[model samples]
Target: MGTKEQLLCLLESNRERYVSGEKLAEAIGVSRNAVWKAVNALRAEGYEIDAVTNKGYALSQENDLLSPQGIERFLPRDHPFNLIVRKLVDSTNDEARRRAIEGAPEGTVVVAEGQTAGKGRRGKEFFSPTATGIYLSIVLRPALQADRAQYLTTAAAVACAQAIEHVAGKQASIKWVNDIYCNGKKVAGILTEGAVDMESGCFDHAVLGIGVNVKPPAEGFPAPLGDIAGSVCDADEKALRNRLVAEVLDRFWGLYRHLPDRSFYDEYRRRCFLLGEPIVITRDESRVRARAVDLTEDFKLVVELPDKTRLELPYGEVSTAHA
Candidate 1:
C-alpha cells in the first residue's frame, strides 16, 4: 500500500472517531507532516478525509473506487491468490498467458482496471472501459483433458452466478457456455482459453477471462446491443464489484479443490438455462433449431429436434435464441 492508501485505511478503520495526526504518524512510522500530505492525496481521490488542524483527520463517508484496496478489504484474510492489480493492459488474459509461460503457479489471478483489447468466445472483441467493470483472468491447470475443457467454463458460470447472488442477493441464470444473465439482460461473460502440450501428460495452463459490466454505459455500446444489454450497477456507480470478487474467489476455491466430485457436475447441470429450452445453433450457413435437453459432464449438448430426432452437439457449436 502507498502512503496515501495507508492513511486512507487508517482513517477508514477509525471512521467512528477522529484519529490524531501524531497517532497516525507513529502508527505508520512516518512524520506528522508526511501523514498530512497523505491525507491530502486521499481527499483528492474522492475520499472524504476531513483534515482538522491540531485535532487530526477523519475519513468522511464517501464514494469508493473499485480499486485494489477496496477489493482486497473484502477478501479472506489468507486468500489463495495474489491480487496482481494493474492500471491498464491490452488484455488480462494475455497477461496471464505470459505469466503462465514463465511457470506461474495455479491460482494466480491477473486483474486490470481497463483492457484495450478484451476478447470473448471465438475471437470476438469485447468492450472494456476504465473502472466500469471487472476485467480479470484466473490461471489454472485442471487435471481434465481437452475433451473436458468446456466444463471449466461451466464451473466459472456457476461460480459467477453464486457470487452475484451473494452480492446482489439476486439469482442469475447461466447461458449455455460462457454468459450469465439476470432479468433477461446480460450482466456477465467469461472466456476460457488454454493450451496443452500433446507429448506431455500435463497441460500447460488455462486462463479464464471474465468481464462484468457493473455500471450502465455512458456511451458506446454496439448498435445491435443497445436495447438488450444492461449492467448490475447501471443505476448505482457504487456496484457489487468488491463483494462479487470475494465471493467468486471463495466459490472457486471450494469447487477447484473438489473438482473430481460428482456433486460439482450436478450443481452445474442444475443451473444451465439452455437445457430443456428451445434454441438455435447457427454456424455460418447451417442453423439447427431445437429444444436443448442435456449437457453431459464432458460438456456436450444433446438437443431434441422438431422431428423428434435427437442431435448430440458439442457446447462449442452454438448460440441460443433470446430468453
Candidate 2:
C-alpha cells in the first residue's frame, strides 16, 4: 500500500481519538512530513481530517468518504478481496464485467460512490444518488452449471439482507427474486450477470451487482420511486458505508464458499415477503395472477394459479397485485 493508503487505515482505526503526527510517523515508519502530506491528500479526496497543533491529527468522526482502506479496516486481515473504489462510475457491474473479461480473478470488487447509469433487473434504472447509497459489484467464478446461476442472486439477497440488519440495526425483508425491503419499501436491489462456456456448460464468470440506499437523497427519492423506495437508515453514521461494504462481502463470502450446500436457501425463503401473498407474475407481455405458496429447494418460487394449478417459476418478475 502507498503512504496515503497506510495513513487512511491508521486514521480510520483511530477515528475516535486524535493521534499525534510523531506517533503516526512512528507507527507507519514514515516521517512527519510524509504524514502531513498524506493528510492533505486525504482531505483533497473529500475526507474530513482535523489537525491540532499539540494533539496532532485525527480523522473526523463524521467522515463518510468511501475508501479501500476504510473498508479494509473492518475486513479480515487475510480476506481475499481486490477492492477498487471510485468517486463516480457509469456502473460498477459494467466495470466488474470488463475486469472479468480481462482475466480478473474471483473476489474482485468494484465500488462506486455514485453512478451515472446505475442498472437494475431487466435493464431498469436504479436510482443511485451520490453520497447516500452503496453501489458495488463482485466478480465470481463459481464452479456451477449455467442452469444454477440463479442461486448466486438468491444467495446475494440473503447476504445483503443480513448485512443491512447487522450494520444498520433494521429489519430487512426479501422481495421474491432480488429486492431487499425495509419498513415495507425497497431499499436495495441485486443484479447478477454472467456468461456460460458453451463447450463446458458452466459459467465463465459472474458479476453480482448490488445497490443499496443507505440514506435518503437530500432531495428525496424521485417522483416515480417515492412511494416504493426507502433507505436502510435515516441517520448517516460515519463509516457506515465502509462497514456495510465489508459486512456484505464477509457474509457473502461465507455463503458463497458453501454454495453447494445451499444453506442460505432457508434464510432466503424465510425473508421472502412475497410468500403467501397474492402476486402478479410478469413474463414478457403476459401477466398472470397467483398466490405465492412456497419456495422450492432450489429457490424457485412455487405459486398456485387462480385455477389451483401449482407452478414452479425458475425465473421471472413478480409484484404484489396491489403494487
Candidate 3:
C-alpha cells in the first residue's frame, strides 16, 4: 500500500476519534508535511477530513465514498475476497470477465463507483450513476456443471435482499429470477455471466454481477425508470455505500461457500413476492398469463396456467398480471 492507502487505513480504523498529524506521521514513518499532503489528497477525492489545532485530522463519519480500505474495515479478518475498488469502469462484469479469462482466482472482486456501460439481464443496461449506487462483480470458479449456473443467481438475490434489510432497515422482497425490490420498487438487480468448458460441459468460471441503487440521483431517475425504480434508502447516511458493499459481500460469501447444501433456498423462497400471485411470463415474442405457485428444487418457477396446466419455467421475464 502507498502512503495514501496507509493513511486511509489508519483514518478508517480510528473513525470514532481524531488522529494527530504527529501520531499519523510517526505511525506511517512519514513526515508531518507528507501526512498533510495525503489528507488533502483524500479530501480532493471526496473524503471528509477535519483538521483542528489540537485534535489534528479526523475522517467524517458521513464520508460515504467507496474504498478498498473502507470496505475491508467491515469485512471479517479471514474473508476470502481479493477486493479491487475503482472510481470508474465500463462495467464491473466486463472487468471481472476479462480478469477471469486471464486466470483470476475465485473470490476476486471488482467494485466500481460508476459504470459507463453497466449491464443487466438479457443485454439490458443497468443504470449506474457515480456516488449513488454500488456496482460490483465477483469471479467464481465453482466446480459445477454448466447447467447448474442458475443457482449462482439465486444465491446472489437472497444475499442482496438480506444485506439491504440489515443495512437499510427495510423489508426486501425478491421478484423471481434475480430482481430485489424494496417498498414495491426495484432496488437491485443481479446478472450472472460465464464461459463454459466446451469439451467438459462444466463452467470454467462465472462472474456474478450485482448492482444496487443505494440512493436516488440528485436529479432523480430517468423518465423511463421513474415509476419502477427506487433506492435502498430515502437519504444518504454515514458510510452507507461502503457498509452496503461489505454487508452484501459478507452475506453472499456465506451462502456461496455452502452452495451445494442449498441452505439459502428456503430463505429465497420465503422472500419471493411472486409466489401464489398471478403473473405474466414473457418468453421471446409470446406472453403467457400464469399463476406462480412454487419454486422447484433447482429454483425454477412452478406456475399454473389458465387451463390448470402446471408448467415449470426455467428462465423468463416475469411481471404481476393486472386485471
Best model per TM-score: 3
Clashing pairs in 1: none
Stretches of candidate 3 above 4 Å error? none
TM-score quality measure for candidate 2: 0.97
Residue-by-residue lDDT tens digits, candidate 3, 66-163: 99999998999999999999999999999999999999999999999999999998889999999999999999999888888888999999999999
Is 1 or 2 the stronger prediction by TM-score?
A: 2
RMSD of each: 2.7, 1.2, 1.1
List where candidate 2 sits over 4 angstroms from the true fold.
Answer: none
Give the CA lDDT, 0 to 100, for residue 246 in model 3: 94
Of candidate 1, the 10-residue stretch with the lowest lDDT total is 59-68
CA lDDT of 264 in candidate 2?
A: 92
What TM-score does each of the candidates earn? 0.88, 0.97, 0.98
